[model samples]
Target chain A: MDYVLTTNALCKNYRHFKALNGFSMHVPKGAIYGFVGKNGAGKTTLIRLICGLQEPTAGDYTLYGINNTDKKIKDSRRRIGAVVETPSIYLNMTAEENLKEQYRILGLPSFADIPELLKLVGLEDTGRKKAKNFSLGMRQRLGIAIALCGDPDFLVLDEPINGLDPQGIIEVRELILKLNRQKQITVLISSHILDELSRLATHYGFIDKGRLVKEISARDLENACRKCIRLEVSDMKVFTRVMDSLRLEYHVLSDTQADIFTKETITRLVLSLAKEGCEVLSLTERDESLESYYVSLIGGTEHE
Target chain B: MNKLLSANFTRLKKDVFLKLCIIFMFAIGALLPVLDYHVMITYEFPRYIDESFFSYTSFMVILFSAFCSLFIGTEYSDGTIRNKLIVGHKRMDIYLSNLTACIIAGVIMCIAYLIPYLLTGIPLLGFFIVDNISTIWIFLGCNLVLLIALAAIFTLVSMLNQNKALSAVICILGLFVLLMLGAMIEDGLNQPEYFEDYAYMDPETKELVIEPSTANPYYIRGTQRQIYEFLSDFLPGSQIIRLSAMDAPSPEILAMYSGIIAVATTSLGIFFFGKEDIK
Candidate 1:
């Protein structure tokens, strides 16, 4: 697995409060890695540390295989674009002007791509209007546009759709998906909006109390949270044999309990189990959402 | 670093506050000379071009204080400083680029004042009346260095403090405080050593009596006076006041002091700014 960003025992402390305590995670080369945690769970702190906005108190991180302490890490950093906490854009400048300014900062040879970049974020028509006049959504999009000016392979956004309306959230979500799928840009987006994040992330890292509790691929998480029929059979040996014979996927939980992951008819299955002398004691349907999985992973109150 | 500097200069060119400051400086430069010319013609009094030539120093101090504050403050207020860092520009480069842009702006403002000052003053009041041409050159050189030092000090204040409004208030108020302190020190240094003795008819009794000379109470002498002299030459505020009056006893030393202040403040600002945790 090629990782674009990797942190090892990364720690950040503000006076007495430890923002990131031995935190560690790996963002693969082409994944929309959703960083999930409650408010003040070191999401922004980690973003700041990786963005070079703040230095870690202990441990280190690597960008594109370059260690944080390496001077060449700056060269590595040029490959990344990030909007930390808020969209870092000049409010007095128009969207086009903001992108031009970023191009100048990046020492680009020309402004030829300014229009295309603006259009990429859906801000191409904001001609002459300063960013101060832009709506919250427009400004967020402009921030993304500015971040894209460098044509970076890695993009980091901190709460990108934090204060947007539903329409705005949809626009940003579609943009992220487009950036990841079409451009193949690796995105590390930190947001507390689990439902929105679940829509875009190919992978997830659940953070709690400054430590990453789990990092799982979206496919694996989906499987873990998949809908299935819970069953308590009279005999696990007979149930496994019947399930295998019927070509049904099942996970054995105990000597008498299992979860059948198929849509086969229950009456026929019961009759077959009866024929095999394996009686069904209990049956119920179970479906777990990403939000519930997050809750269970972090062991916090619901809706946190 | 070059890229950051290019970006800063591009921003500086479009800065409305800076354009206003430049216009105000040119207006002051062009008007003060005309006013002095009006007085010379109306009152039949002699006025030298040097009188108002260095006057731009005082205005530069105030304008640069305000300009550097708001300019750098806008970065923090708008959060654009993060763009530079996120793009992998070194903190040292960011600080230096800002300082360079500000110093150039300060120089441009000075030139904006000088163009009119020279155009009007040379034709009306004539060239410098000082004994040595080098004195004029020294003052001019030291004044330019003084502007650089002023930019450095204001940049330090603005860069270290993230809040734009607060840094502007501090820079403006800080200038006034330094000026007041400089004026007080200059006043102490200007006191005469002693009062002359004289004989006069007493108002109460019609008798003439001779009195001996007594030491001037306000006189600052010895080491205290030396410290005061060094300060008048060292501090940017005092240097501005002295240069405006064309009373710099050691222009080279003043320029050196300005150089030291410029280097010191910039070093301190960059060091602290590097350690600052940007949000």
Candidate 2:
């Protein structure tokens, strides 16, 4: 598999606090990798480490095959564009002016692409309006626009939609998808909004307490959260016997509750259970959601 | 680096505070000469015209502080410094670029004041009023060096801090404190070495009576005087006051001190800034 970014036991500490502990993740090329972690779960810390804003305390990471400690890692970073936490921008500068500053910083050949960049991020009409006056969504888009200035192949956005309204969230999502598909840019977006992330992420890395609990593909997550039927039966022993005889795959949740994964007609299932002297009190058709899957992986109370 | 410098200058052109500061410098330049002309006409006082030309240096210290602090402070508050690093520009390059731009701003402001002062002063109060013809030239050179030093100090203060308002306060307050210290030291250095005692004939006899002579405690003597004098030349504030007075100021020594300050502060600023963690 071709990966644009990968980490091996990446660790970072702030004095006595461990921000990132043995965090290892992989972002495949052209994949919208969602980094799922609660607040203070080292999502921003990992972003900072990779973006070269802060150095790792121990372990290391590779960007496009260059190790973090190598002097040439700076060259590797040339391929990355990041909007960490809040967008890094000059509030005094207008949208176009901000991008021009970024262009100058990148030593681009000309300002020829500034307009196109603004257009790409849907800020083409924000003429002479300073970034300070821009709405939260517009500022976020401008931040994304600035990041896209150097045409980086990999974009790392930390909490890209933290404070955006629903519309703003949708716009950012579509922009990310467009960038990944049309521009062929690999995106590593860390967001805690699991449902929203489910719509876009091709892969996921679930982190808890600075450790990656699981790394799963979207298809695999869907398969893991496949459709199942939850049943509350009168007798557990009879329910198991009936399910065994029927050869239906299921998981026992409690003495009286069980989830059946195999598909069968509702009439047929009730009839089969009745023959085994099992009375179904309640039955529910259920499909596990991403939130439950994440909870299951991390295995704890809500941290959000 | 050239790109960084160019971009900084481009930004500086649009900086409102710097524009206001330049205008302020010019206003002072035009006003100070007229004030000197008034003092000369009203009291026939010996108005030092050459000294009046460089009166801008005294105010440039605080003006430079405000300009340098707020200008660099924006980078921290806005988080634009990370952008430069993200684009692969060296930290040293960014720091030096900012320092250079501020120095240029200081120069422009100084000239903005100098031009108006000379334009008004020479016609009203006459030129070359001082005995030494080269004092004005040396004073101008010293003022430039002092500006460099002041720029260095303010740059260090501003770059070390991430809060814009706090940085400005520190820079401004730092200039004021240095000014007070410089004035105190100059006052100490100006003390007399000895007290003179006079003798007069007594009314009872045809004889002279000698009064008691005492040592001047305020007089800075020996190594202490040397230290105070060296300090007067070393401190930017002291240099400002000294240059304003034009008290046989040595252009070479002032330039050397300013060079030391510029190099020292810039090196330290770059080192700390390179190690700083950008949010």
Candidate 3:
């Protein structure tokens, strides 16, 4: 797989506390990789280490094939833009002024792309409004705009939708989607809001207790948490017989309940059960959500 | 580094606090001479225009420190420093760029005070009253060195602190403490070696009374005096106090000390800042 970012046994220790312990993951190129973890589960720690905000205690990572220990890693970082934990921006400057300042920091040649980047982030009209006076969402968008100063190909956002109103969250969500889809910019978004993350992420890295528990593509995750038909029948033996004859995949929950993995026609199911002397009591179509799949995979609730 | 310096300069141009501080210094510059002019006209007292103008060095230290603190503190408060690091600029470059910007700011502030004072004082009072033109130039040079050293010290304090308000307080308080120490040392160094004796008619005794002379307490007589004199020359604060009198005989040594202070503080500041896990 073509990965824009890859980590190998990356570790970060803060005195006695290990923030990231042997954590590893991959963010494929052009993929909006969702970094899923509970609070303090090393999601932000990994982001910080990667963004050069903090150093890792041991091991290393590569960005655009440049190793972290290499001096040229700084050059590699030119391809990355990150808003870690909070939006790193100058609050005293207006949105336009802030972008211009970031351009200056990045040593960009001109201010020509300022308006376009602002427009892309839906902040083109925030003229003359200093970032301190901006709403939380506006500030978040402005932070993203600052990160996009040099037109970086890879973006890393630490809790991008955090503390946003519903409207704000939707706006940010749409913006991330647009950036991924239209611009083909790869993104590494660390967020605990799995439901929202599920909507945007083409890949996921589930982290727990400073380690990566799993790394799964959206397609595989969907398959593992796919839709199923739940059935309640009069007899388990007859239902098993009917399922076996029909060659359908299922999980038996109780003596009388079974969940069929395939999408079978209701009439055909009933007929097949009837011929096997199985009386159908009730059936309900259900799909395993990302949240439930995560809970089941990690053997705990999201709150954990 | 050039880009960072230019960016800082851009910010400095728009900084309202800096602008206000410069304006305040200019006001003091213009007003002090005007007040001296009033004193000269009304009381017919002899006054030196150059002295009145150069006296601003004392207050300019505090003003310069306060401005540098606010200017550098804003980076931490606004998380703008992270922006530079994120863009691949070295930490050393950021620290030095800020130091350079603050140095430039300090110079501008001094000029703001100097220009008005020179324009008003040279015409109102006289051209030079220190006897020698070189003495006046040496004093100006001493003030410049002291300003750079002060800028470096304030930058170290301000950048090391993550809290803006706390850094501001530390920068101002630090300058005030140094100023007080400098004044104390300068006062001690000015003490006379001997005390005078007096004989007078006692009011109560109705006879002549004699009081014996004792050594001046503030006067130094040993190696402690050497240490004090070295400190007076070495410290930027003491240098400012001494230069205010326009009698810095070895202004070159003071400039060297200032250079050392600037280099030492800047090196330490950059090292510490490089280790800082910028949030």
- CAPRI-style quality class for the chain A–B interface of candidate 2: medium
Worst 10 residues of 3 chain A by lDDT: A295-304
Where does candidate 1 stray beyond 4 Å?
A245-247, A253-257, A263-271, A279-284, A302-304, B198-212
lDDT against the true structure, per candidate, is: 0.92, 0.87, 0.87
DockQ of 3: 0.63
Which tens-of-lDDT digit does each residue in B62-177 have in candidate 2?
Answer: 88899999999998888887777776677788889989999999999988898998899888878777677776777778778778888888888888888999999999998999
The residue-level lDDT of candidate 1 at B40 comes to 98
Query: How big is the positional error of residue A223 in model 2, measured in Å on the Cα after superposition?
Result: 1.6
Top lDDT prediction, candidate number: 1
Better of 1 and 3 by TM-score: 1
Query: Which residue runs does candidate 3 get wrong by more than 4 Å?
Result: A229-260, A265-287, A301-303
What digit string (tens of lDDT, one per residue) describes model 3 on residues A1-304?
7888899999888889988999888889999999988898899889878888778889899999999899999998888888987888788889999888888888888999888999988998988888889999999999999998888999999999999999999999999999989989999999999889999999999988899999999998887687988889999998887888889998898998988998789999999889878899999888888887777667665445
Clashing pairs in 3: none
Q: Model 1 over residues B1-279: C-alpha lDDT tens digits?
A: 999998999899889999999999999988888899999999999999988888888767888899999999999999999999988999999999999999999989989999998898889888988888888888889988888888889999988898999999999999999999989988889888988898999988889988989999999988998999889889877888899888877788989999999999999999999999987
- How many residue pairs clash per model? 0, 0, 0
- Can you give the DockQ of every candidate in the order shown? 0.87, 0.57, 0.63
- Candidate 2 lDDT over A1-304, as tens digits, reads 9989999999888899999999899999999999998888899999888888877888999999999888898898889898988888889889888988888777787999888998888999988889999999998999899889889999999889989999999999999999999999999999999999999999999998999999999998886788999999999999999899899998898999998988999999999999878999999998889998888778757553
Model 3 docking grade = medium
Best by TM-score: 1
